[model samples]
Target chain A: MAPVGFRSVEVALQAGGPRRTKASCHTLMEPGMFIYTETPEIQKLRKNIVELVLTDHPLDCLTCEVNGNCELQDTAARVGIRKVRYPDGENHLDREKDLSHPYPHFRPVEMHPVLPLCAGLR
Target chain B: MGTPLRVVVDEMGGGFREPVKALHIGGPLGGLVPMSKIDDLSIDFESFASNGFLLGHASILSVPERFPLVKYLEHLFAFTAHESCGKCFPCRIGSVRGKELLQKAQSENYQIDRELWNDLLETLEKGSLCALGGGIPLPVKNAMQYFSEELKPYFSRG
Candidate 1:
């Protein structure tokens, strides 16, 4: 189960007391913990992130190799980036794609300690 | 400082020349000025601050007439992104985004919103953890201010 309550740092430490092994205790285990507060600045930062990613991206959403399984697409959606800030002509689409690698690709979630999510690059 | 100091300009072709339009000082992120403003400007701290330029430890980048100022700014951001330490949130992400925006603007022919661009620049300038992130926008803004007419062809109303 996920932690749903909070105590003072002092209280929490005391509660864990002598019985606590490193594995026995943790902090801010909730998925929403450390959530980014959406200020105007944060919103701009997010928009800029989308703009940057799309610069090299072909934006071939319908025909991409990853198609519905792309992390870049998901990030764009989550950030509410409805439109790219820059023009599409500037993307360096001349670079060749390398598809010969045999290894399976997955984006490892670096979110936190407990639950990790993986999006495969197939 | 302005009387004795000499400005250097470099064309992308790896040759250095005197400023045809503006002289870039203080590395890639430093302020730029038109050649007409050269004698009026000084190289001292106070003068640099007042004129929106940097002393840049005698480092000067001479951009010729045809050199794309916007693309140069974009590359500066790219370099900053590559060198960022990743310890701070703003610098790590902001540089990457700034690089992208510049690329897109160049690619799209500058059809982007002016307000949005300014806001993002403001955030990077204020929030970056180091000079790498914060200072990269200086030259960009300076270019826009002094070279707006030259850059207009790269933009559209929509």
Candidate 2:
């Protein structure tokens, strides 16, 4: 549950409380509990959330590396976010990528082969 | 906890020497109550929540008349952005976007789209993983409700 609003399972277990916990996609439906996943309100929330994320994210999906394979792109499409409603403002899309470590170097170069052999022996 | 707000401010803390506009009770994620309502409110969770406010942490911060409410709202958003643990998307991205929106409104006299602003608030309130992102909208909404006149310039005409 990535965006579960409930603090814990105990909180969710409480029923008819003054402040009822907002259920996430992964919240299990129990007996006597009614969960509406596809209500109009939920649909609107889904779209709005996608739009909010898009407001800060770069909109250069067409030119981006993970254009088709991106989860965000898929969610945006699913939610039918036609436009990002927020006005133009500051964003981190244009920030320079930190390229200090171009390639990762492994330590103990000679031990690499021996380690694999040791693992195989085990 | 049932102590009157006036008792807390005037009696215990020694009343403000200067004119104050509002009281930001409960900390950064708390409710912002205008002076007019201060007399009716009490230092209790139910009292605050009944009026669309929060009694979080029970801390009080006085807002002076000279301090712009819009700037205060911007600071709340900025604080949210700074403190977010980046464990979730809505808090991490939404906080930064909200701060940016307020910055543009303050600097360029921009009028943010009303529908979009509500949408952002709803997302933060409902989609965040924890209270850090969820509770921030409480004070911002309070400002929109109680200090509407001051925030009028920043909202679109529609």
DockQ of every predicted complex? 0.06, 0.27
Worst 10 residues of 2 chain B by lDDT: B85-94
**All candidates: TM-score of chain A:** 0.46, 0.57
Tens digits of per-residue lDDT for model 2, B1-158: 79998898889999998899988988999888899998888888889889878888988899999999888888999999999876555677788888888889889958888877888888788777789999899989989988898899998964
Q: What is the C-alpha lDDT of each candidate?
A: 0.56, 0.73
How well does each candidate reproduce the native contacts, as fnat? 0.05, 0.49
The residue-by-residue lDDT of candidate 1 on B1-158, one tens digit each, is 54433332222234344436667777766787667666656557777778777777646666777877777777788888889775333456567766776677676544556766675676567555457777877888888788888766655552
Give each model a TM-score: 0.55, 0.79
The CAPRI-style docking tier of model 2 reads acceptable
User: Number of backbone collisions per candidate, in order?
Assistant: 4, 0
Residue lDDT tens for model 2, A27-103: 65555554455666677877776676576677877887777876667778987888887776666556554333422
